[model samples]
Target: MAPRSAVLLATRNVLYVSIAGDLIVAAIKVGAAAYTGGSAMWSEAVHSLVDSSNSILLLYGVHRAKRTPDQEHPFGYGREIYFWSFVVAVQVFALGAGVALVEGVTHVLHPTPIAFAEVNYIVLGLSALFDGATWLIALRGFRRGAGDSDLFQAMRASKDPPSFMVVFEDSAALIGLVIALVGSYLSIRLDLPILDGVASILISLVLALTAVFLARETKGLLIGESADPAIVMSLLRIAREMEGVAHANGILTVHLAPRQIAVALSLEFSDELQTPALEIKVSELEQRLRALHPEVIAVFVKPQTALGYAEAVERRRGKTRQIVFHTPSPPGPA
Candidate 1:
């Protein structure tokens, strides 16, 4: 199978596992919350439900993103994944964090003794076990995608949001479960039922932070992020080494999808090379680039003098700087 297809299948499998685990956990949490009237348990139930929904949305995004290139969208529908992932982040903030915060605050205002606190503890323990399993699955996928990078670094470097997003969501869920267990225990032992509400608030905070981080990460991709620096360097090196290439001015690379990159190169051919020779050289360079980096889907080579290319780049940079300087800043608080 193709690499892109492989990646999509792997993502779908992981999401399927997550969805199943979340459905089970949510059901258990809801029953426990109904029976024991624990605010934290209720919050957990909601969290699980939201997670399940997110998995479905991510799967849908993956599906939509895989659509073949069309006349309307010549670049294909790759950015659809970024768009839907951003939506997932917003949903996490709205449905997951927003609901949890409101529920927590309501419980804090009207503190109520938790019935059968032991039941909540039991459910939380089981839920933790289940969530941990799903978390491990996500972590393994993320680690494979990351190669040798650490978790935080992997998250930042990952172009595929679903890979890391699931990891973050599951990690938060596990932490929330631990907090709920502690809060339930403390509430029972100390007769401080309000601690349950505080626990829910803490869980909401975790979800909110995760949502914000996901949003920040996905925003760049949605707005057309560049390809990896290493990939860009490799492309330039390949072009420069070509026989008829006088100078490789610069390379511009952008990710059309996680595994799809579009490359544009400005090359100054040797004066000694004829038009036919330059055409052949360009084709050779394109093939070499694709061979070196299979992710490069499209390549455009433009014939230009090195001096002209440099001047154009400088003008572009100056305009960007001017725009940045002239942009209005938000007003500071009084």
Candidate 2:
């Protein structure tokens, strides 16, 4: 809806880069943990595994939301993006946070010895490097697309998938890497291997917080939130400007999706209007309304009063025309 070409391409690039990097890093972390016998490395590996899953889920949402509108869903599947994003959040909470918390608790209860401190550091460094590139690209996309809008509004209105998911996941991954490094270094230096598990707990907490935020937003969309307050005000103003419109009978706007809306309104007209002219007035109102609010995909206008005014005007015009026709014929004959 908004200029989507740049945003779409950026989204795709961000997805691929993040997915590849996360998956690779996850594998390396898991393997390094197994080889070095470091609980911290294991916790990070699990965190990355969940990150990879969340990225995949976001990609799925991006693709599904792009599907064309069908008979059962004439409004299009744009909202499906939010649905899939919700699933991603759930995965972050369930898979990432849940696993990390469990591992952290286990380490706190029963400590393990650290053997792969050097390897864990190397793996963490590599993960950070890869995350940096993905984050920069995603940030650039957000800057170009988000502009003055708030992040939630941008995500809500964005037709492009990458701008939302890629940016979020990449940012999370970068932060997670830093946290993992700190936990690992602390565990190795203090000879308190259980601290590695504590790192996992912290990662879990971060994921949970992110998931909760996303859940609240996505749930609002699923239940249907109102459009921007400004847009609603704009529509009301435009309706009041109509020539025959007494006032906007009422204005109702529903957010069908991030970029689409359905509007239904009642219109009260003057007491002395005519049918033919009323048709012209209706057409004018529709055109002006569309121009004022592009998100208004559909508008239904109902006349709030009886057609008495329009019918009276028609009757008056008919009588006037009849008298003129008769008068003109008599003059010619004379």
lDDT by candidate, in order shown: 0.90, 0.73
lDDT of 2 at 30: 87
TM-score of each: 0.93, 0.79
What residue pairs clash in candidate 1, if any at all? none
Best model number under lDDT: 1
lDDT of 1 by residue, 116-173 (tens): 8778878998999999999999999878778886889879878899899999999999
What tens-digit string does per-residue lDDT give for candidate 2 at 24-53?
888888899888776656767877787777
Off by over 4 Å in 2: 1-6, 149-162, 272-283, 305-334
Summed over model 1, clashes come to 0
Q: Which candidate ranks first by TM-score, i.e. highest? A: 1
Worst 10-residue lDDT window for candidate 2 reads: 320-329
